[model samples]
Target: MRRGIGLAAVLVIGCGGGSEPGGIVPLSEEPAYAVVLSDYTSTAIAMVRADGTAVDERWVTSGTETPGLVAALSGDVAIPSAGLGDGTLWLLDRFRTDVLTRIEVPSGEVLGQVRTHDAGEGESGWSSNPHDVALIADDLAWISRFEPNLDPAAPELERGNDLYAIDPSTMTRRGMRIGLSQYDVEVAGADGTSATAFARPSSIVRLGDVLVVGLARLTVAFDGAGPGAIAEVTIATGETRLIELEGLHDCARVVPAGERAIVGCAGFGDMAGKRATAGIAVVELVDGHVEITRTLRFGDDEQLPVASQGVVHVDADRVLAFEWGAFDPATPDRLFEIDLATGSAVEIASSAGPFELGSPLFDGAEDLALVPDASRGLRRFVRGEDGTWSEMDAIELATDLALPVRHIARL
Candidate 1:
């Protein structure tokens, strides 16, 4: 039930072997490729030749309407399907169409289907609002869950923010609660509520043995007027440490140069307000200790604050950041290259102009992929010699690919 792109949108992205001046340089050497899953309509998964030739298009899932997220590592692609309102969870084998498994986190059972429901309701159920998934080791799956916002304005019963370290071999759930504390609350708003009581964690990234979780601390409720920071939780011991900040959103990666972890804090005061003083925070993660070394802000501070929704740290020195024009998923996006050594940001590529870039795939310093809006499929990007970015062939994916891409890892 996947809809192919219309002739008009295809032409805008240079279909029929056409060319444009500001176009991404065509990919010269084909590499492994796949399409990001958007919800249950089974998007696309494909392999591309080094010179940008489409090798195949396969459907990874069969369910429609249920959005899924894809995470590919080694030789396996992990696809987690979102449940409706009954606490049911679905996991699909993206490479093989016949391989699919579903589980209920709360009940620990292999049911045909489970329902996803709001947290504050009468019946008890686990929220399948799966935001991100990562495969830390063979048999171990780390799933990040964003609890459903019952009150888009002001949620009364806030109970569900968690990270599960599941052993895929046993189907057992090893879970931990991920949250933050706000110390910067104004006196007028303070009411004996500790900062840790109402912290909302957004994303999580696992670097080796350390799991770095992004926390949006609340300075105020509903409005999301709060200080932002990243919490580093050790996977082995489960001990957590918080990196505090005034305004922040997402965190990036652990650079290997000084063995530092780079985080992107959304510096926007409100959804539409101007950028503030804080930018990307580079902290050193050694052994199991986390310390902030520098804060890269925009302008004289020579730092460009990273907009949330998309960010990738390829290495210590080079990082890929997505500058979101608006909070809307449909809003246009831009990619910036941040240099950690000098603490500066330079716009490298953009999807708003010629091609629309959705979730980006950063293979390394020279490789990246931009999933064009469902209309056009996935476009691969590989850095060229002249400080330019080029595109390869369109990605082929499973006809049943059912998830939006949460993150990408090259096999």
Candidate 2:
């Protein structure tokens, strides 16, 4: 069940590794633009024109420093609001950002803000760490939690998951606590001695009726206890299945093509270990069973690890992947066009700086938006008719969200 596409051997493109002496192509393309919550101290959600111009920037004046952590662009609308999964749009007090502000999506009216009594131990905290949000149809919001509330020495608190069934029309929080569990890890690869590891809830994808979940795996020594296998939980039935692998870090949303899912595997540790595996791994979905298909690596140095952050299926034969800059700062953050047809990949374009790319989003309609790092914000790039690349000029949008802008979804 393992398809090995082998390697095309692309030379590792390091940061600041440029070919033309003139420097990055001057951005000329201008497209539609919009910014969400731009008035705040930091910018979070934004909409850009097909030509690279930012349309508008709206700064959700949530008093919290990191408002865009779970923000999204409402369906078919340019406004960036915090609502998804069951139609629950999130509203924070403009005066007090940490307060749970609720707002209805349909009419843009404010509902009562959520209030909480201190639960003592792991209950009340200074900050709210809402990891990922999934839109269930348009009624329920499935919000994941990864609270880094513990100091380095203190034992990590019992982390739980929340599923909010918000009334789309009223924007009220419903079905708040769905499930809770200990922090989990993902498996990327395994050898006889030790397996590579990843941490919990790195990425989540909704597939078919069930949500295919991917977490970071902590590849520990086989001799002792380590991360459990990667698992999937059924939202409807609450059934969980472990799709075991050896090492894993982050995973992009499932690409719906035929029945296969293309998962990007980064190297071993936080680039801490001496050895690592950098490539793209594939999983097949059949009869509700998850199976590993094939792993494709870019370029020759298999050791040069490709930390794929995002992937999208363009066609049966072609797919797009984002390669975060590895090891060297000069390594260009690369956009790889993978050809399953030849088991080969090509570097279509790259930002020479270490633009630590967040997950990539393809409107599929035309434009592409990529967030670099959790704190640095986002930069919009557009492809032109001539096939050359450039930045958008008209619409100026901010990418950094103070807190890391880890994920982005097209609503």
For 1-411, candidate 2 gives per-residue lDDT tens digits of: 111122222212122111122222222332233233332333343334444344333323222222112222211111212223322234322221222334333222233333211224544543333444555644454544323323233223323322223433333345444432343433334444443332344244556666555544443342222332334657687566756444433342344444565655553444443124445566666687666666554433453336455676655656667666655646757776676556666665565455555455454456454433333355555656664445543223443333333334433
Determine which window of 10 residues in candidate 1 has minimal summed lDDT.
Answer: 2-11
TM-scores of the candidates in the order shown: 0.60, 0.60
Q: Looking at candidate 2, what is the lDDT of residue 213?
A: 55
The parts of candidate 2 lying over 4 Å away from their true place are: 1-41, 49-52, 59-122, 125-128, 137-139, 148-158, 161-199, 218-229, 250-261, 270-275, 297-307, 326-330, 367-395, 398-408
Q: What is the C-alpha RMSD of each candidate to the true structure, in Å?
A: 12.0, 13.5
lDDT of residue 59 for candidate 1: 21
Whole-model Cα lDDT of every candidate shown, in order: 0.44, 0.41
lDDT of 1 at 278: 37
